[model samples]
Target: MVPITRTVPAPSSVRTARAPRRVTRPAIPGVVLAVIGLGAMAVVSLWWRDTPVIHGFGAMLTGAGQVLGLLSGYGFVVLVALMARLPPLERGIGADRLARWHAMGGRYVISLVTGHVLAITWGYAVTAHESVTSEAVTLLTSYPDVLMATVAWFLLLGIAAFSARAARRRLAYETWYYAHLYTYLAIALAFSHQFADGASFAGNLAARVAWSSLYALIGGLIAWYRLVTPLLMFARHRFTVAGVRPEAPGIVSVYITGRDLDALGAEPGQFFRWRFLARSLAWQSHPYSLSAMPRPDMMRITVKARGDHSGSLSSLRPGTRVIAEGPYGAFTPALSGRRVLLVAGGVGITPIRAMFAALPRRMSEGITLIYRASNPRDIVFRQELDAIAADRGAVVHYVVGSRARLGYDPLSALYLRAMVPGLHRYEAYVCGPAGMTRAVVAALRASGLRRRRIHHETFDF
Candidate 1:
């Protein structure tokens, strides 16, 4: 840990003129996805409307059930596509937002499917003049594919129950991740029923082809990006742990060496889900942001001992085999705006450090880092930060104190406004623990920075 120190005063000669904005690649707007989703729902509703029999209570109930079923199918395919790790969405919308979208979309699927079950069963019972319970059991046992679909319904409900915030917080990341994989199985079973007896597709060849094509495209994306691409990269790169070094107490940096790693195309501030083939470690993979720019043959990821998995990183020996699944994240220079302001709390500094190294700058007056930690001992890479600051003419401000202590305030809006001159003129990059991120984001917004200019990355489930 480095000692608490005041930031270097802004160079008097530093111009007050606002830094010009960096031209960014035009991102495919997120609303494009929203519009498509709405359009698919409308298509289903239109299909229901075109039906010959349009009136009775039982008929209407069945019709509504069919619409809900169609929407759930749309939800299944789109949700899977979002998680397929496509490069376009990964680079444009980013991992954090993508995960959030998937979660919200999952909620919609739950509602749609739940409605489908109730409405379909109720309608059949009314038409047959049987009890709802008997109708449900009859459908499950008698209908082709319905029994499998019933299994899928229960699987989906179980997933939804565990995905609730309270339940998810108690589960291990590995456990939660593996449980989610069952979603693929659930969708497969559900899709089979759609073809066997789906009201919308009955006697409709065009509908069958369109829906099948959608699923086939999604399958190809998953097979290529999730399975085949990773295997090819593994064979080509042959990544292996070169060494692990402690940067601070309970924090270690792992150096990975591989063949032709330059071809990986990983940028600073990006992360990879690393699966190390070692004792007690081969069971799961974890995301760690790159702590340094990747070289042709090697790369580095810094980890803090936050849990059993992360704490055990220091125990990994050199020469361990590694499989990495990303280069994922949008927290890079591609999102840069005007001037750069890097805000790092605890180990969140990992990505900030890498970005600092790669930031092309003749003068760093416009670049500043606000490194926050509870105390000096919690700070990592203090020496390297100073070296980079000295070489790049940037300033590093270590805000060290416990937030719970009285008269121990740092990282306040006032403090930030003073530390980074022309506060509203910079494009701020913030990475930290959840609490700190929320606080810093609020502070940045209070100080007049636009939401668009403050880019951050998070994987907090």
Candidate 2:
């Protein structure tokens, strides 16, 4: 294991006074859900008011299509808003949970769109005494914005296909990220078609205005949070690459130097979407957790060579400009119990390592960290971890070995109970690869911890 040292002094640009306390708002998620539910109710009411009577099968199908289209449009707004990188939602709800919601919501919205297209085409065909295929062609050729809508539908379908687990695994991270940006174009095309042909909006100024307002609100949020905020942060902080130090064979820590970094309010377990302004790296931004505590003028993020983007960070030159978009995620020690248990697997040790150092100095109970690695050499920051554990009077356990060599999984429920008695009383924080994280979480639950007591975040998305 490589030894590391921290001797950098606080820069003059940072405030000498204490940092302000962060106010935690736990009700943001519930409030957001309530707002979504209200919007859905309004959509249903609009359909109910506009669609009073249904006499024939064709009318019924058309009505169903209209309802589906309305809900889907509203859903698109909600979907984009969820991922707008808004601080409240990102910090309050956590990025991982929001990502899960966005993914599941995308599937539902796609299904609704597919059903709308089929039902509308078939219903129009029956009403006009024509075949489904004929009606579809006619709609595309004759209806205002219908061709654009059709194009948008196909784009959405393609995106959904690529977003699947298997497809995502085959594609590079950059490709997947850039492909998802086409969602903005698809939503714009769909919006035009909605106003052009929607029954509820036909000659209804109030309905059109309301729908337009909703879109504008969500668009404004995306513009401000995703675009404007980052620009402002970049200009204010003027971040740059200070240096990069190798930790292991394929892992290195990037030290970022900036102005007034403390003003960014980054906690130990939070992360930033880092965009390095350099050849082949300027266009893509990747999320990397801070491996150490934030300083007034510097911060550190440890990256493992998991992919092309991460692998290339080893070559980053000092003084390279950097654009960061966050201090996001809610995985800090604020939510942990008196007696805390920290679990880390492989590169997941980055965030866990930071939190371990930040744990309260005097705990009534104690703090324990279990690091799972495939081998002794794979253990990162070993010297630093031992130093912190000894200085803080915390316990550090390194579980090193492959499953085959060990003859069993060391992180199983039975083993966890033997390793740490009364595991249920401690709040656990886990970070690691998706498979290992899931296994550890399952083991923790089985060992008597409640779901709420265990916190974890995966970067698989």
Candidate 3:
């Protein structure tokens, strides 16, 4: 395994919560139980194939597992569709959680699909022992939709295997994206088969109603997350490119404006996934933090053109229609009760800047911003910070060292009293590269700050 080093600074008060060593034992017992259940059902079904009561009981239990598997499958689809349409989910929520669900859900899908195939195959083998495969194949072929479902299952398995991080890293985003698109096809196939070929749904009215109602709920979530939310966003915030300007080397700021002030109700420190509709940059949809707070009619998305997608954003023209799907995440500093201590590194200062601008006047809450970057050039909105500092008594400490190809930064003892003196009193909000955020949070925690008093945002994904 490749060793992954966490770049967080050592905390003064490290909380020791070690993970349990033996967690896999439960899986063994669960698998054993499942096997026993399957075996008992198979034996009973074979012995009483013609009897309605026995067959129905056996079918009901197996059907429950299959239905559960479909729900998991639907969950996987909904997550994908929603993530694509929302901004805060893709970044602040972290890709790790989504990836975990994808993995576990895939396993459930496999178990369900396997149970479905095995149970049906066993029933066929017992009743039509001589030509099981041939008869099943003939039956499927007779029903075109069933054949489509079989093809869909093959596709689902192939896609599931390809979804491994190793394989995904090798594939282009578009290719990976399209491959997963086959999920909708797979779900359609599976659902159709459940209603058509299965006796569980056909003969039993209650089962059919229950199953259909469950499917409707899943479908509703998918529609809300994907279609309805996006449409509402577009209708309310008709975001058009207000201005596009380069902040630093390759970093472009795209200002956008919506219909009305109240209509585009996004708080400061929130971000959006921006997709510029320019023909050349159509495929480029990325998450960018709002550099400035929402005015009566405008918002800003500042992008550091680093990757293959981001680098092309510099050439985008003004007045470009950018589809923004967001106002997601709970990273805002308002969550914590203590005074705000904003920590920013490099371009990560964008959100911090917005928060400062949007802060209400005559505010009793104390605010301190620690701006850390290699040099002064990397500080995106220095002028704005000066204005904010002058307007409010908010203390702004600018730490510019090791930037501009400079060697080393002297450890400045700024904000030492603010943190250590108060110890457990202040709320620390951090946003930057993963390493920077981790290090800052660690250092703050080390200085006797409570974990609940710390809020951080890392745009690693």
Best by TM-score: 2
Cand. 2 TM to true fold = 0.94
Question: TM-scores of the models, in the given order?
Answer: 0.91, 0.94, 0.69
Provide the overall lDDT of each model, using Cα atoms, as 2-decimal numbers.
0.80, 0.86, 0.61
**Model 3 ranges with Cα > 4 A deviation:** 1-147, 170-172, 197-200, 213-225, 228-237, 360-365, 374-376, 399-423, 438-448
Sum up the clashes in candidate 3: 2
lDDT of 3 at 75: 48
Q: How would you encode candidate 3's per-residue C-alpha lDDT over 361-425 as one tens digit per residue? A: 44325767788888666777666687677766777788777734554332222244443346357
Off by over 4 Å in 1: 1-23, 29-32, 335-338, 406-409
- Using TM-score as the measure, what is the rank order of every candidate, best first? 2, 1, 3
Position 273, candidate 3: lDDT: 66
As for candidate 3, its clashing pairs are 12-446, 374-403
Error at 72, model 2, angstroms: 1.3
Candidate 2's residue-wise lDDT over 88-143, tens digit each? Answer: 88888889989988999999999999999999999898888899999999999999
